[model samples]
Target chain A: MTRLIDVENLTLRFSTDEGMITAVDNVSFSLEAGEVMGLVGESGSGKSVTAKSLMKLNASNASYSDETKITLHLDDGPVNVMDLKTSKDMKVVRGGAISMIFQEPMASFAPAITIGDQMVEQLQIHTDMNSKQAREVSIEMLDRVGISDAAQRFKQYAFELSGGMRQRAMIAMALSTKPKLLIADEPTTALDVTIQAQVIDLMKDLVKEFGMGIIFITHDLGVIAQTADKVAVMYLGRLVEQGAVRDVIRNPAHPYTRGLLAALPQLDDLEKPLVPIPGDIPSPLERPPGCVFNTRCEEKVGDICSAKVPDFTNVTENHRAACHIYTQGSDK
Target chain B: MSDDVLISARDLSVHYPLAKGGLFGPKPVVKAVEGVNLDIAKGSFFGLVGESGSGKTTLGRACLKAAPITRGTVRYTDGDVDYSLTEIDNTQLKDYRTRSQLIFQDPYAALSPRMTVRDIIAEPLEVMGLTNGREETDERVREIAAKCRLNLEHLRRFPHAFSGGQRQRISIARALVSRPRFVVADESVAALDVSIQADVLNLLRDIQQEMGLTFLFISHDLSVVAHVCDHVAVMYLGRLVETAPTKDLFKAPRHPYTKALLSAIPSLDPDDPNKAQKLEGEIPSPTNPPPGCKFQTRCPFAVDKCRVDEPKLEHSSTDHVVACHRWQELME
Candidate 1:
């Protein structure tokens, strides 16, 4: 199992009008080939930011910490993605080794260009394929994604297709380059459930066939539970919990994780009252002194929780959570 | 099950004329809601579930008289007053506005940026002339804001100062300020984070209970629908495909579309082993819907009969209706 991507101590901030606001604080995660890691969080939790950071897609105002490091392990060699200063150097991360699909497929696809043309362009840029070859491969990719009349669809603009088809086309374009990793940023959020199901299944099958690692960023736990091999729970720009999807979901350690699970309206159990974590998520500018989630955490562990950030504590063999409850009386 | 029907919509249809007339003599129409029938019990949290172009939003809007009703009789009877929404005049419509309110989907866009939370909430009361004076308006605003868990100090601030969840709470407060008996929440929690969605949902449920209101909760998320709604109706291509109690619908769905929808929800349990029976193809175009059963194109059990003759909603059991020629056989 080769490491596809490894991000360490990724502290990111933006120079906004309000002040320097930290978006991703000391986050760390790695992806293995053919494994799917689900990044689950609410709005402003920076799940999307973390995914974007992988491809250096954050805006110009964004700043990275000195200790931050992003290593992309490709077939050729390991490349320090964070060190890539030029757009040409960054291209290897963008469409060569990694590809991304956004929530809005319509926004991703050009209204003027046909879906086939865009996919062909992606293939031509990443691979040594000619115009004719790219067109054949694009049509094949379109067909592979369950699109009927692929040739006919090849000539149709994005607006001509339905929402589900547009998403499928987006997926086709993203995967056409045969990248080693895929970052799907809420790819199905805008879609209907039935269509989302089909897309999820398609991505899963594609992962198996392509042997590509995927970082699936979404707020929907059900989608994460079904698709992800591992799950990472984020809150206020920090990774609160990281573990196997089953362990993390079944026996969550972090209070935030517990609160999230409790908040969800689970179909398996309808009798449980939805208990939202009290208090609003504190603004980034007015961030709590210590643990980012201390403002809303129900099980506050005295002054230490408010004084110092809790380090990650192992809950089980493959599960870990950042919480003061697990660190009580531990040596400094 | 009870004869306490607050709203009974019979043969409800909403049609929008196209800008350009079709090749034929008659102008082409977009049948947003075609031949829909529903009975919403008083004080019931009725869920309307559908994907894009399924007409759930249009149906909800029609109930509120926000969308034009081409043909139908929407009988609104709340013990105090009885009026046909479709045939209501200007005065009746104005009165209906006070009794029936709509909570929009986007919290960010729903609130006017220029107005303070207090003013935003009080606007409905003022516009309807429900409040006699400034003190009365303030009193009502403060009361509803408190119910929505908003603080008095917070009410003085603009919506831009609030978070997505907080803004949604404000939206809820604004909608409930007039003390409307019938509330239409169209994807109200869809914009919020998963954790915040639960908070807003709990708030909606609490308000409903406290005020004894009837809610037409329109959404695309089945899991969320299963949680909050007492009775759920499934829509496809502007037609009601199935209707049942929430638990009954999730437990034993009869219609193929209903069953497919239930299965399509990505299960929270990772090792459930129940492979999602993914529906094939996109939902057929609403502009030119498929003949007969709307779901026939994507339904695995679709037959020639399903493609030629539209199936009317038929009862399977008490309070459980399904529209499918082979629902009985499919259930077995």
Candidate 2:
């Protein structure tokens, strides 16, 4: 009930002009304090590069590899978020102990600032707040995210708000510095499914009033079965399964999570049909050497899922997966 | 009507105008398909749901006149073919653009990355002349790329070498290789992967019953338009609040903006989470909309005569219709 963020064999790579490309491959998982977790996949399946490598937010031809640890468990004790190493030690691991939110809240705001001056300049650059107590805690976190005239919608701007009020003013400027790990990534993929179900019931009421740890990312498996209390999945950039969102949405131990839940069309099933897991997911410079879903797997174990890389297998007691047809002697 | 109804519209509208106006600024326009009647019955599939400035891709490109019809009338017909998209010109709008096509919604910008999938599906029958040799356009682009499961040897490769459901089946084999007796598609599986969006919606409902064609589809995924539409319709800001038969709008969804968009859809039984009657704000600016039930600005039972009258879409039963103003007091 309180571990909050840890990762281990988390390898990553990039050196781009088409060379060492892996993007978060040996991924591991953990996150507890008010858990949410989900990651899901598709779209270069690295699930927003593992929630932007928990706040390092990759870029400049990213190439930091091997034993990629991360840690965190705070109360001023275990924080090595990959040994921070300056941007002023990643300002307490970005937004004061992690607070992401992305999939474009108008390209992460600043269309000439305003939403209460970009949430009082992100609570005066990560708190020790000033400017009238960061404009009274950014209009009380934009009236606790429902955002109605929250002090005149905090003086307006991100193109005068709406894409669900610029994602509830980017989740009230990433929960006005209340961060013990948030991440988000596809924050309701450019909204509008009733504003992505009111931003997933406002991130499940800001995870029951900020107990915090979310992670979330999404390629919408019904928004990771309604805001994931653990679920992992991803593909081409590996981490194959992980579980307990009702055991991977009711028993889905990877045939690419049962072809992404029989290619989901179930509003209580309308005479089922979307089977599609038949080929074509192979490119990040033609990756498929080993189960990056053995070229669209429909239970393929041939040449052991195109030559090895299976590992994980625990399959319940809160799931796990990876695949050579769920391992044990590899069904060969 | 077995003699296929290919296309229909009847009320249509496509608007646009306003580029930085002046002269007393009155004529501003941008309705983006306001009148909106529809038919598309021929080989039937029909869907169209909404949200994203709900014009459902400009009422599916103004029913293939490819936008800018601005107001009313369209007809098309098919067996013994008739026309009339309000005086079809420019060579019968280049012969109704080879019987109406579309398919778009970005397979990474609908493939023109230096063309290849055999010249982007034979550049729509070599720019609509249909097929004047290259062995009859490679035997009709190898029979619509093997009826879109694709792989007539991945047609000489390129769309950055496929995947996103094989470039949405090479954008549905270039909108069904000019055989198009009306197609539209628009958010063609809204950029794939929910298991390749139900395998490009069951390959557009098996190429609309194997090329007797018709389609339309557009989507904001109401459970993949209730398992691929047989008449759906919904839309919102630019009108048409209901229209049924997809199991009577998923069994009794008579428009309070189609039951808050089918209860803001996130139900895969995560212990029944859909508390969806959320809408209390945003979605107004269809250029200052919200006068008369264009969903009275985030409707929750909106009244005051629904902000001064304007509800008329009616027919609540046989073939559904709706448009609210208290959909009969939320259906009693």
Q: Tell me each candidate's TM-score.
A: 0.97, 0.37
What tens-digit string does per-residue lDDT give for candidate 1 at B125-221? Answer: 8888887899989998999988999988888899999888899999888888888889999999888777788889998998899889999999988
The most accurate candidate by lDDT is 1
The segments of candidate 1 whose C-alpha lies over 4 angstroms from its true place after superposition are: A329-332
Record all residue pairs in model 1 with backbone atoms less than 3 Å apart, i.e. clashing: none
Per-model i-RMS: 1.2, 10.8
Q: Please report how far candidate 1 places residue B195 from its true position, in Å.
A: 1.4
Q: Write the per-residue lDDT of candidate 2 for residues B137-223, one digit (tens) a residue.
A: 989888888988787876887887666778888888887887978888877887777767777788778778877787878888788
lDDT of each: 0.90, 0.80
The ten-residue window of minimal lDDT in model 2 chain B covers B1-10
Go through the candidates in order and give each one's DockQ.
Answer: 0.80, 0.29
